[model samples]
Target: MAQRLADLADQGCPNFFDSQRFGKDNSNLKRLAQWINGDINVTKRHEKSLLLSALRAAEFNRQLGQRVQNRTWQTLVPGDVAILDGSNSHFSVASVDAELSARAAANDIHPAGVLPGADDSIAGAPPLLAELMQRERLQRAYRPLRLRIQQLAWQFVADDLILTMRLPRGAYASGVIRHIFDLQSD
Candidate 1:
């Protein structure tokens, strides 16, 4: 069972953001658009923080969409930030090589995209994504573009199935659920 769990974890999960990220009626996104348009004037620290987060999340989602369209969301690209599985540590891959592709395919490393911010530490991103970061005034930072489940187990009970799993800190559960279910919007 332990080996099976490890094998399952190595299969990897989609690196997409779920609806919960957009908030109720995507109000966070509306707030972000307002801030981008200079229509919002925030004096409170919390308000500023939320707006910043919304801005970043919006950009991340946009980049994720592009990756999915390009069919590279599950694979590594040249000049991509490859994040090490289970660690915050990551390094830039200047070019895609067979070994790197194999490693990424094995779920040992993940390709990351930018989380717009002004931080100087965020480096080695694709040119277009970096440009978008500057235009959005999002601090340039990298976030693992993938999520890997740990200790995942499942069983069928009657007509329903139950899953037990652990995700890394900051990983969203909705991403995993989406793969197995067609969630509806209410």
Candidate 2:
């Protein structure tokens, strides 16, 4: 599909085929290791095997970054909270405000056990989609962007090989950047 798009005179999908996708590594990788095989409680070789699988996943993501190297940055400001506004636009940053900020925490909570009165029909839903819905939601931690991420702002720069996201005390900037940056090890 990508190769086909490349052949087009005008090129491929502007937002995805030619846009940057930064994936993040779990900061808890070390801790997860301890829980899996660091001589904790009952350790099993299987735990180590699973850990290896995780490492492989992270490594694979790193390789994906290389694949998207030619992708462009859609109007995404450095500190912007790039929210996926559906498949139409890659993302649109919402200026942080008390009202918008109020929903931040709620949105980040991963759904666990069923809601008190929620219907369990779970019918007509794909198990995968349902599970994904139950997965914890990512919180926005981007400090209000100092500027707009205009497509024509400047030549997209891929500066630091090691990128650092300093989010607000209560925000999850990484939560947002995780979607675009490679936070995994090579």
Candidate 3:
């Protein structure tokens, strides 16, 4: 399927087509290039359709990109992610924190009691305790899958694009996309 789309995109697909995940058919696709031109003419419907296709494309891109990213634990400080080193041990960092959170929530964990906010003062508390709280929260966020990698392969058709992502066992390919979309997983 992707090979076909790649061929189509390379030559310019002569007709509109859609991947079931993206849409039925995009009437607005032709208009996407209009924004780059000077003085565009668009009726209300054309503008709306164009906007929809662009939005869908943006969403598709976002999800596709995450496939190569590492899944982190949640209860983090709202920034940064928990990355796993080759040893499979986890470390924390900034960026893609939402992915961490989603992983945690999926595992039925939350950050509330895990993180020791600055105000926390317990007698002889280990300095690392605070850090541990934050990371443990991330551990809970894991979605039952051990650390793994996902990848998105793309095929562009003259009409539209098809995106593909393969996930690890116990991980949901579509569930990952739900990170960006409000749509329920079927």
Candidate 4:
């Protein structure tokens, strides 16, 4: 069991925020919008936290979707903050050169998207997005563009394929599973 745990830790999964953070029908997000627009004042700390989480998740998902659509989620763009795989350290790419592109392609590093927070380190996203964030009064933060899967294995049993793996904190198992199967949630 100890060895198994060690192996799982050695291989980390992609970092993604799970759906639990977003309430059903995104009601929390709607409430957050009301608060941001000054239509409501959130007094409870828990409620405020939920709203903040929803907003951050929404922003991160938007950026990730954009990158995936452009076929550049695995690639890097200018002014992108690239995080080294399996490590927390990251750097800003002011320009895309051959070496940097090669590194990104090799998964040595992946581009990160802003999480919309108060003290973001780098600032190079689209101006329109920035404007929107400004209007929403969100802070700036960075999050990786890609989610990595490691030590992935599966087996079929009784008409079910059991998948076994480990994911790093912030990565969602459902997010990974959804990619493999068309699942419907109740």
Candidate 5:
């Protein structure tokens, strides 16, 4: 078990926003779509903010999921936005060079996915997400496609496994856990 956990740590995990971000049973997403279509009204400022956040998160997940499925989530590709490790700083990748590849392998940087917003270009964005960005007047953003686990350690004690690791803010612990275990909710 420890070996398996260590392997996962070395491999890192997909930097996906946990399902909880979308609210129970993805209610927030449902509400956001309803609000967008004028089928429901979101009057409270806080509620509106939550819905918007969920909207952005959902879009980010969609883009990230695509990369994961394509097996490119951990590697650089032309036109990718690469975020420097441990910082929000990012730049567009015109090409993938040897140095960039080394940095990515060492966890110095990671490929980023778009969080669509009003200022973000609609090019390359899915039609529905682009329309939502235009409608919501959102700001452009990017998130890393892979999350590196820091200070990872684990131990087994009498039929239980204990794991410890540090993650950057906004990175989900479940993102790591999902790689090693199947999860269920009560």
Candidate 6:
């Protein structure tokens, strides 16, 4: 189990926003959809913010999921927005070269996925999210697709495994756990 964990740690985890970002049973996302379609109105500032956050998180997750499916989550692709490690700074990729590939492999940078909003030109955005962007006039952004796990350590106590690691801000611990265990969220 320890060796397996080590191997998994070296591979990093998909930078997915865990279920908590969507609220209970993803109620926030549902509400955002309702508001987008004009079926409901969100007037409160905090409520509006929450709905917007959920929308962005959902879109980011969708984009990251696609990269994972295509086995490109950890590799550089043409036209990818690459984010600098430990920073929000990112740059658009015109093409993938050896330097970019090496930086990605060394965890010096990561491929970013889009957070849908106004002026987001990336094609194939979901119609609902695109509509929300058009209605809200929100600014688009990017988030890294791979999360690096630092100082990973694990131990067994009384037949239970305990894991510890440091993740960057806005990163979910469950993102690491999912690679080692099957997680079901309610």
Which structure among the candidates has the greatest TM-score? 6
Model 3, CA-based lDDT: 0.36
lDDT of 1: 0.71
For candidate 6, write residues 1-186 as lDDT tens digits.
Answer: 787788767867889999889999999989987887789988888998899888789878888989999999999899999999889899999999999999999889999998867777435545766766676778878899998888889999999999989898888987678777856555
State how far residue 172 of model 1 sits from its true place (Å): 1.6
> What number of clashing residue pairs does each candidate have, in the order they appear?
6, 10, 10, 8, 1, 0
lDDT tens per residue, model 2, 2-89? 2332222122112211112122345333534444343343246564334333433333333233334633122232333433221112
| lDDT for 105 (candidate 5) | 88
Worst 10 residues of 4 by lDDT: 5-14
TM-score of each: 0.78, 0.22, 0.26, 0.74, 0.87, 0.88
- Deviation from native of the Cα of residue 94 in model 4, angstroms: 2.0
Residue 22 displacement in candidate 5 (angstroms): 0.7
Regions of model 3 farther than 4 Å from truth: 1-30, 49-53, 67-186
C-alpha local distance difference test of each model: 0.71, 0.29, 0.36, 0.69, 0.83, 0.85
Q: Which is superior by TM-score, 2 or 5? A: 5
Off by over 4 Å in 6: 121-135, 184-186
Q: List the residue pairs that clash in candidate 5.
A: 118-138
Q: Tens digits of per-residue lDDT for model 4 on 131-178?
A: 435544665667777776667676668777777876656778887766
Number of the top candidate by lDDT? 6
Candidate 2 error regions (>4 Å): 1-28, 32-42, 71-186
Tens-place lDDT per residue, model 5, 7-98, is 66786888989888899999998887787676887788799778878877877888888998999999999999999998989999999999
Per-residue error at 89 for model 1, in Å?
1.6
